[model samples]
Structure formats: C-alpha cells, structure tokens
Target: MVQIPQEILDQAKELRAQLHAAPELSGQERETEGLLKDFLKKRTTLELVEEDGWFYGVHREGDQLPNVALRADMDAISGENGPYHGCGHDGHSAILAGAALACEGKTLGKNLFFLFQPAEETGKGAMQCREMLKKEKIQAIYGLHNLPGFPLGTVMIRAGTFACASVGITLLFQGAQSHAAYPENGRNPAFAICRLVGELSSILSPENYQGLVLATVVHLLVGEKAFGVSAGEGELSLTLRAHRSEDLALLKEKICQQAEALAQADGLTLTISYQDEFPDTTNPPQLCQRFEAALKKSGIPVSQLQEPMRWSEDFGWYLKETEGLFFGLGAGEDCPGLHTPEYEFRDELLAKGIQSLLTAVFL
Candidate 1:
C-alpha cells in the first residue's frame, strides 16, 4: 500500500474543515471553486484546466491521452444554518486534491486528470462536464462518496447499477375559486388531489415495472387557508426513482398521463415541470473489476452491494459518456447520516480516501 505523506493528509484535513465552515449550494460554488484552484496551484506542479464551474489537473510526460479520470464534487446541501457540507463533498474535494498532490513528480505510465465538479446535489454538474471529457480524451473515469454506515475506510461498490435514476416532478392544478358557503359554485381540485395521490401510490409496486421503481410524494400545497373561501389552486410534488433510465422515463410518462386524465375529469388545468434529473449510474464490468482489484491490492476491506442504492447521483451522467466506476469509502459504522444537520465528515479517512483514489488512477 502506498502511504499518503502526513503533511499532505494534514493539509487535506485543514482544507476539508475550511470548506465545511463555508458551504455553497448546487451551482453556486464560486467560493469553493476558488479555494480548490488556489490549493492546486500552490501544492501541485501539474497544469490545471478550468471550464465553466468545473476544473481539472492533468499529469503527463508527453502528448499521451489520459487513460483515466478521477472526479470529486464541490457543492454542499442546504442546511438550517445555511449551506452545509453535510454530504461530505468537502472531504471528497480535499481527497481529490490530495491525489493530485501525490501524483506530482511521479512517473505513472498513463496520464491522469483530477476533476473538481460542482452542483452534484442538484444533478446538473456532471452533464456540464461532458465537454471536458471529450476534450481530454479520457478513456475511463472513477469517483467515490463517503458512506456513513460502514467501517471507516471500507470500500463499498458493485458491478452493475450502483445508483438509481431519479427526477423531481411538480404538478399544478388550477380551478375556479368559490366561497366556502357555496363551494359547489366553483370547480375545486381537492377531490382530484386525493385521487391522484392514491393513484400515485398504486404506481409504486415493483410488479408494475421491469425493475425497482418508486414514487414519493414529497410536498403538497392545497388551496388557501382562508376560512370563508374554498381554494381552487393546488400543487403536488413527487420524486420518482427507477433503476433504469428507460423505466424512469416510462414511469414519469405514466404519472403525467394519469395526472392529466384526472385534471381533465375534474375540470382543472394541469401543468408539469421537472427538476433534479439524474441518470442511472451503471458501472462497466471490467472497470468495476479493476476498482475491486485495486482496493484488494491496497488491503482495504471491500463490501459488494447486492442492489443499486435508491438515492440518485449526478455522476451518473459521466457513465453515459465513458466507462467508469463509482464507489463508496465508508466513513464510520456509527457516523451521522448524510445531508443531516449532525453529519460531519470523518477526518481519519482522509489518507485512506486519497490512497484509494490514487490506486484507482494507477490501476
């Protein structure tokens, strides 16, 4: 196993703490980007590349194309205090930085690129980085996330779909308002809302689709709370997930169709909007094997997951462009859950995370 120098690990820990203190949400990652750029410039000798909100550092002796790329997300999730690094992206960025620093002045047979991405929580960053992949001629890519429920530094991954595809859908129902005393005088969508909710629940069964699919009603807003008036406007928001992108698309279409039919039957106008779209992250078999082999060679404990996680990751977009592997490094068996207010990234895993990334790059 290659050990990360103590100074490098300490620097990474300090960087992670600085990032956690001031987090940015989704596409708003300007401060985080600046900090990362400054770190790379001061610590690594490799030339850095910047495009949009994303950036990368390349290490090569000649004109050889990069054989593999390593990526880390730089944005944080929303928190009660403000934007927070509750998802451990701050650690991810620092780890990638450590990897870049480790590769400096080393003569690896293949070229390497370290990518720092933005807006992963909102599922838009990877798609935007697609252009970078093409320009860099990267053959394969690798990424990692910190998992909370496993032993610290344990590597968790699988060969097939690692994470599900998901999207957020919003349905707006508009109808005529009427006085509460004469509710019958105007069209009300309260009935339609109830019917749609029930129908949406019915769609959650796996038997209705080829694989796992789920629809969660995240938010609902009914008509105004005025005591004298019956509300005619209502909004329903749902997050839909499926193991395959095709299945997700079909599921989305079915939900929209059912919603439209219900709105028509109730004499209401329906409008739909989608957000936070994520594609299914499918790992190529050979790349996954290489990742597992690398982890085994490093003497890290490896956990092979039997099923794809229900949560969505924007890194799924990268798989669509090139073969890749996305794995998880366990933070701790009893660590707080991701995106929760109490969640803090495990500083002890910094050296191991950096080494795991370096192993994958050199594998």
Candidate 2:
C-alpha cells in the first residue's frame, strides 16, 4: 500500500474542514472553486487548467501513456437554512486534491487528469466537464462516492449500471376559468389531474418493465386557494427513474402520452417539460475489472453489488463519452445517510480515498 505522509494527511484534513465549513450551492461555487484551486497550487506541481465554472489538474509523465481522468464533485446541496455540505462533496474534492499531493513526486506511466466539477446535485456538472474528456483524449476515467450503511473502507463495485437514470418531469394544464356556481362552464383541470394521479400506480406497475422502473408523484396542484373562483389550471410534477436508459426514455414517453390524452379529454392546453436529466452510469466490464484489480493489489476490501443504486449521479454523463468506473467508498454502517442534516463527511476516509486514486493510476 502507498503510505501518505503524516504532514500531507494533516493538510488534507484541514482542506476538508475548510470546505465543509463554508459550502456553496451548485452552479454558484465560486468560492469553493477558489479554495480547491489554491489548495492544488500550494501542494502539487500538476499544471492547473481553469474553465468557466470548474477546473482540472494535469500531470504529464512524458511517457507515451494513455490519459486517465479522476473526477470529484465540489458543489454542496441547498439546505433549509442555507447551502451546506450534507452530501459530502467537500470530502470528495479534498480526496482528489490529496491525491494530487501524493502524486507530485511519483513517476507514474499514465498521464493523470483530476476533474473538480460543480453543479452535480442538479445533474449539470458532468455535462459541463464532458468536453474536457475529448480535449484531453482521456481513454478512461474513475470516480467514487462515500456510501453510508456499509462497512467503513469497503469498496463497492457493480458490473453494469452503477447508478440509475432519472429526470424531473412537469405537466402544466391551462383552461378557462368561470364562476364557482357555473363549474361546468369552465375547463377546470381538477378531474383530469386527479384521474392521472389515480392511474399512476397502474402506469408504473412493476410487471410493465424488465428492470427497476419508478415514477413518483412529487407534486400536484389544481388552481388557487380561493374557493370563489373556479379552478382552471393545474400542474403535476413527477420524478422518473429506471436502471436502464432505454427504460427511462420509454417510461417518460408513456407518462407524457397519458398526460396528453387526459388533457385532450378535458380540452385543456398541456405543456410538458423536463429537467435534472441523468443517464445511467454504466461501467464497461474491462474498466470494472481494472479497478477491482487495482484495489485488490493494494489489499483494499472490495465488494460487488447485485443491483444499481436508485439515486441518480451526473457521472453518467462522463460514461457517455468514455469508458469509466464509478464505485463507492464505504462510510461505515452507523454513519448518517447523505443529504441529512446530521450528516458530515468522515475525515478518516481521506487517506484511503487518496490511496485508491493513486493505486488506480500507478499500480
């Protein structure tokens, strides 16, 4: 195992604390980016490249080695009071930075690139950084997330889909309003929206698809709070998720078709839109094998998962452009789950996270 020096570990801990103390929201991580960039400059000799909203570090070995990239999300989630690091992105960014420190004097054969991405919570970060893969000619990439409810230091890997594909869907209905006494005179969408909600279960029945498919009704609305005015508008919001991209696409089509039919039946104008889209984070077999071998060589405890995670990861965007492996670093069974107010990143995982990255590139 590659041992990280005590002083470098100390620095990493300090960096993680700094990041955790002052978190920024996605797409507005100016200060977060500044902190990470400054940390890299002070610790590593890797050439830094700055982009519009994100940045990366390049370590060239002068050998004709294949370019490999390692990525970490840097943006925090928006909490009730303010932005906070409930998602542990602070730990992730520090891990990549710590790895950069460990890689400074090493003579590795691979050209290593470290990506610090922003806006991951909304599924926009990887899309912003996808162009970097093509520009750097990166042959392969690797990334990891800390998984609670698992034994600490255990590495988790999956064969095909590591994370599911998901998208936020919204259906807006518009109709003519009339007096409360003359309800039939107005094209109120209450009946149509209620009917759609009632049919959700049947539409998303487990028997309808081969893999895991889910459609959740996150929100529903029918007109205003005022009882005197007949309701003529409504909105339905849903979150669609599936283990396969094709299944996700088909699920979306089915829901939209159903909504259109309901709107047509009521003579209401319907508009459908989507946001926070993510593809499935599928791992190529060869790359998965390579990562597993690297972890084993370092004697890291590794486990294979039978099913893909239901939560969406923007890292899927990177896999669309190149072969990559996205795995999980366990945060202990007793740890608080991600995005919880009680949750904070486990600083003890810093050295191990760095070691895994170093092994993937240098082992």
Candidate 3:
C-alpha cells in the first residue's frame, strides 16, 4: 500500500470539512463546482468542455492512451434538511480531488478523465453528460460511496446490483369549492387525499413493493391555510423507492388507480407526476474484480454486502449506458447513517478512499 503524504491528507480533510458545512442542493452546485474547479487548477491541466455546472479534467503526459473516466457527484440532497455532510459526499469529492493531486506526473499508460457532475440528487446529471463522453472514447469507469457499517480503510465490492432504483413522486388533488355549512354542495378533497393515503399504505408490503416502497406525504395543504373556508384545491407529494422495475411500475399503477378512484368518488381532479427517478446500480463483475484485486493488494480487508442497498443513486444510469464499477469506502462501525442531521463523515476514510481510487486508476 502506498502511503498518502500527510500534507496532502490534511489539505483534503480541510476541504471536506469546508464543503460539509455548506452543501448546495442538486442543480445548485455552482459554488461547490467553482471550489472544485479552483482546486483542480492547482493540481492539473483541466480544459472545460461542457459548461453549465459540469467539468472535465485530463491528466496528460505527452500522450493519451487507455483513456479512463473517474466520476464524483457534486450535488447535495434536500433533507440534508440543511447543510451537514451526513452522506460522506463531501468525502467522495475530496478523495476525487486528492487522487487528481496525487496523479500529477504519474503515468499508468492510461489517460485520466475526471468528471465532477452536478444534480445527482435529482437523478438527471448523468444522462445529460452521457453524450459528451462518447467523444472521449473512455474504456473504464470507477466510482465510490462511503459505507456506514464497515470499518475505515475497508472497501466493499460485489458483482451486481449495489444499490436499488429510486423515484421521487409528487401528486396533487383538486376539488370544487363549497361552504362549510352546506356539506353536500361540493366535494371535499381533504377526505379524498386521506382515503388515497390509506389505500396506498396498505398495499406497500414487503412482498409487493420489493426492497422499500416508502411513501411520505411531504406536502399536504388544503384551502387557503384557513380552517373556516372549504378547500377548493388540495395537494399531496410523496417519494417512492423500489428494488425491482416491476415493483416500481406496480406501485405507480396502484397510485394512479387509487387517485382515479378517489377523484371519481369525491369529484376531484388528481394530477400525479414522477420526478427525480434514479435507476438501480449494477456493478460490472469484470471492472469490480480489478478494484477488488487492488484492495487486496492494499491489505484492506473487504466485506462483500449480502444485498443491494434500498437507497437510490444517479450513478446507476451510467452503469446502464456503459460498463462500470461503483464501490463503498467503509467509514467504520460508529459512523452515522447517511443524511442524518447528527451524522458526520469520518476523517480517517479520506486517506483510504484516495489510496483506493489511485490504486484502481493505475492498475
């Protein structure tokens, strides 16, 4: 295992902590991208190809052969409910930047393409940038995420399905207005929304929805925020996550059925839309084997996960388009679960993650 210089590690940790304090939600990673662009400037020669919050850098040594792509997402989540790096994304970005710094003048007979993507939180960035990569003619890809249950310096690798599919769903209900005194005059959408919720909840079983069919009413509003007036319009929003495509489609069908039934019964207008759909991630065995070998060479013990994660990732889309491997950088037994308010990314993993990526890049 190559030891990462202390001076470099300290600088990476400082950058991670600074990013953790102020994270921008999806599409809004202007400042974060700016910070990364500036950081890369001090490291290598990066030519901006596609504008609009996305960047690519090349580490060239008089030739470009065996071109490979390394990606790190730059967007933060909403329930990040405010800026605190519970997901260790800050750590991911830092490691990517650190790997670039470490690669200065280092040649593996392969060219490096560093992609700092935006809006992974919204599940749209990968597909948007897909067209540009075709011109680069990249042959290999490797990405990483921090795992909470494993020890620092530990890496997790598996052949297939590292993370499940995730879709963010939003539904709205509208009904005719009526007087509170005359109950029969108009339909009450509040009651219809309640009924739809109940029916949807009952069908979300472990067998029916696959991995996790969670439906949360993120927004439920009726009337003009006044109890005295009868509501003419009502809105309800939810997020749905599924392990299988069948389950995702089934859940969507059930939601539409329940909405239609509720609309007919209550004489309300129901509008449902699916947003922020992130497909399930499947790791290529061939590519993952390379990483697994690298970890073993580094003397890092790895625990293979028994199952794919229920949490969704936009990285899955890339796996769909090309052969790739996404692994977990273990954060230790005491690390907090991702997206928690109190959870903070482990600092020790910074060195391990950077080393792991560097090992893969050169191998």
Candidate 4:
C-alpha cells in the first residue's frame, strides 16, 4: 500500500463533506465544479480546463506517447430538492481529488489525465466530454462508481455490457372540458388517462423477453378546481428503462402509438417528449484486463459482477473515444441506495479509492 499523506486525506474528507452538504443534480453541477476547481487549483502543477462545467486536469508526468486517464463523476442524480448526498459521489470526487493531490510530483509512467465528469447520472455529459477528449492521444481511461451492494474495499470490475440501456419518457393528454353532471357535454381526459394507465400496465409478451412497462402519472393537472367540472387537460411524465436498447426503442414507439391511438379514439390529442438518451455501457476487454492486473497488483478483493444492472451511465460515450474501463468501489455494508432522500456518502473510503487510481496511473 502507498503511504498517502494525512493532509491529503484530511483535505479530501473536507472536500467530500463540503460537496455532500449541497449536492446538485445532473447538468446543474456548478457547486461540484466550484469545489473541485478550488481544491485542485493550487494543489499541483496540472493543466486544467472546464468544458460546460466538466473539469479535465492533465498531469504532465512524462513524455510517454500514450496517456492514461483516471476519471470520477462530478454530478448528482435527479430528484434533489435540497441536497441529499446519498450516492457516495462525494467520495468518488474526493478520491479523484486525493489521487490528484497524491500524484503532485510522483513518477507516473505516462501522461495522466484526471477527468472530473459532470452529469454521469443522466448519461449526457460523458458523451459531451468524450467528443472533446477524442482529439487527444489517450491510450486508456478508467472510471469508477461507488457500490453499496458489495463489501467495502472490494472492487466490482467487469468487461462487456456492465449496465443496461435506458430512456426517459414524458407524455401529455389533452381534451375538451365539460360539466361533471352533463356526461356527453365534453370529453373527460380522466377516462383516457385511466385507460392509458391500464393498457401500459398490462403490456407484456406471453413468451420470453419478459419485462414490465410502468406508466406512472408523476404530474397530473386539471383545469377546473371545482368538483362540478371535469378535467379537460392532463399531463404525465414517465421513465422507460430496459435491458436492451432495442427493447427501449420498441417500447417507446409502442407507448406513443398506443397512447395516440387511445387519444384519437377518445377524441383527444396527445403529445410525447423523450430526451437525454443513454445507451448500454460496455467495457472493453483489453482495458478490463489492465484493470484486473492493476487491482491484483494492488492486492484488492475484486469480483466480476454476476448480472448487468439496469442503471445507465454516460461514460458509455467515453468508450467511443478511447480505450476505457469503468468499475465500482464499495462504500460500506449499509450505505443507502442512490437518489434516496436519506442517502449519505461514506467518507472513509476516500484513501482506498485514491490508492486504486494511483496504482492505475503508475501502471
């Protein structure tokens, strides 16, 4: 194990706590960038640049032709009304910062890049940064997420399709209003909404490829406030996630087509909006071998995950640019699942994550 400095750990913990107190959602990671910017600005001799709040700091260690990058996400998941740091992203960011601080004047075999990516939760920012980083001669890039299901200090590393593809769905239902008593006076969208919900719930195949389609009316709006009048207009926001991108595409098409058909039959108009798409994340084989070698050399408990999770990350885009492998680090036994209100990151894993990154860079 490398002998990391106490000040480095202390500074990392402080940065983690500061970031934890005010977690920002995807694409709105200003506080994250600010924290990392301030923490890394005066600590080392790396070159830094910010692209749409995404921070990339290049450490010029040697004249190696191919560069190695160690990356950590800097954005939080959606549904953060106030600042819930449950995902341990703070620990990831702090570990990246600690790695940067530790490698201040160390001898890395190649030019090292520390990528502080934004919007990993939503799956857009990684592709955006990937386009920019594609111009550079990067031989390998590495990334990690905090794992709660696994044991602490146990690295969950795998090659090929570790996560599934997902899509975000939003729908709107619009119709004419009428008096509550006069049944035929106007078209009530409530009936249409109810029918759509019912249809969406029961959409499944009789054979294999078994999956569920959930149509939750997250936001509902009615024109009239009084009970005497029926609702004329209604809106819905739904999220569609599946194991296969083809499944996602087919389901989305079917959802819109079914909803449209239902609305047309009910004398109503429907609208759909889906954006910020992300595909399945597949880790390269050679890169995964490199990670396994590094982790083995570092003497860490490592495991190849059994199943590919439904969760998606934007680093899928990074794989398109250069050879990269994204892995997971365990926080603790009882850490909360991500995006929960009571989710708080464990701070003690900072040094361990940093050490892992250090081993990667030195390789």
Q: How big is the positional error of residue 363 in model 3, measured in Å on the Cα after superposition? A: 6.5
Model 4, span 75-119: residue lDDT tens? 765564754565677788899989999988876667888888877
TM-score for each of the candidates: 0.96, 0.98, 0.88, 0.87
Predicted model with the maximum TM-score = 2
Residue 322's lDDT within candidate 2 is 87
Model 2, span 8-74: residue lDDT tens: 8899899999999889999998998999999988778889999999999999986578899999999
Model 4 vs. true fold: TM: 0.87
Which number leads on lDDT? 2
lDDT of 1 by residue, 153-228 (tens): 8888888888999999999999999999999998888889889899876766677787899898899998877989
Better model by TM-score, 3 or 4?
3
The candidate 2 region of ten consecutive residues with least summed lDDT is 354-363
Candidate 1: segments with Cα more than 4 A from true spot: none
lDDT of 4 at 11: 95
Residue 166, model 3: Cα distance from true site in angstroms: 1.7
For residue 360, give model 4's deviation from the true position in Å. Answer: 4.1
Evaluate all candidate structures by whole-model CA lDDT and list the values in order.
Answer: 0.88, 0.90, 0.76, 0.75
